[model samples]
Target: MSERLPPNTKIRGTGFNISDFWSWGFSDVLTNSLRGVFAEFLVGSTLDVLQQPRIEWDAYDLMYKDKKIEVKSAAYIQSWHEGQYSKISFGIEAKRAYNYATRSYTPEPVRNADLYVFCLLYEKDANLIDVLNTEQWHFYIVKTNVLNTLFPQQKRISLSTLEKITQPVSFTEIKETIDQAIYQ
Candidate 1:
């Protein structure tokens, strides 16, 4: 894994810095890719796993204690002009696991994580939307076994189906909920 450089690290023979690139590239937190990574960061922070830099293109998004976590995020209001709130669904497809040591993909498709954390930026009003606010987010933590049993071959899961599988938890309850899911 490549070490995460400090934001203040300066570019070679230039006035630019890593923070400059971050601001230029990732200022739009509402976009799918950035939002997904943000959700993972939130989960990692809640679980006290932000001590290390995130592993990109890994089989799972996080590892807290013994549980491997996958994070998926979607927002009601999009960065684009969708006129209305966007439809909410999360990808739950099985994927070929990547082995970092071997630097290769697994032969068979699999759900490599122990759990999934579905994060919803639930603020519908674009004018009042705040991606940084914890209250605006709702998280649903579900075991991989449950998903495999219910949606073995499904690629995406609608919000209604996700709700039926598990109720949403707030930011404060995430760690406790995950503990219960892991230990119970």
Candidate 2:
């Protein structure tokens, strides 16, 4: 009554391969977790930013010299439909306060790190969603204070709006741009 895909067989008629279909079925938690890991790997390898050791809580994801960097990633083609273009947003959360006396967290608007690096995978054609293709990925860097002031009371920002503040940089330019922002 049911049919199963043959081993080592590629599905035809559909634009996506088996892996794409498989990824499409992933839940939001798993999808976001994987995206974060991928972003960390790209930043760590390309910019030579060292990943912080695993901890229960971390304010930042990577360390570059004395500066702390937080990396965020989003792809247009997720586990759902593949549109013509992908729109990505970065979460600019208001800082949380840890009260030593109460042993609880409180809401506060504070800069969590020196810089925020946003990795966006904007596919020219959503049908070709390949993680291995670096050409499809774009990296943008912005100072936390600048973001805090520009997007006050906002929890997220779009790529287009971010470009108005600072132009997107290539992977090779990420380190240099970040250094300039840090020391400036």
Most accurate candidate by TM-score: 1
Tens-digit per-residue lDDT, 1-184, candidate 1: 5677899999889899999989999999988888899999999999998877887788999998878999999988888836787899999999999887897999999888999999999998888888899999999999999999999999999999999989999999999999999997
Q: Per model, how many backbone clashes are there?
A: 0, 0
| Runs with alpha carbons beyond 4 Å of true place in candidate 1 | none
Per-candidate Cα RMSD to the true structure, in Å, reads 1.2, 9.8
Tens-place lDDT per residue, model 2, 19-128, is 67656654342255676777777777776654343332556777788787888898777755545445678887867746556778766656577899998877655457
Estimate candidate 2's alpha-carbon lDDT, on a 0 to 1 scale. 0.73
Evaluate model 1: give its TM-score: 0.95
- Candidate 2 regions exceeding 4 Å error are 1-30, 51-56, 82-86, 97-109
TM-score of every prediction relative to native: 0.95, 0.71
For lDDT, the strongest prediction is: 1
User: How many backbone overlaps does candidate 1 show?
Assistant: 0
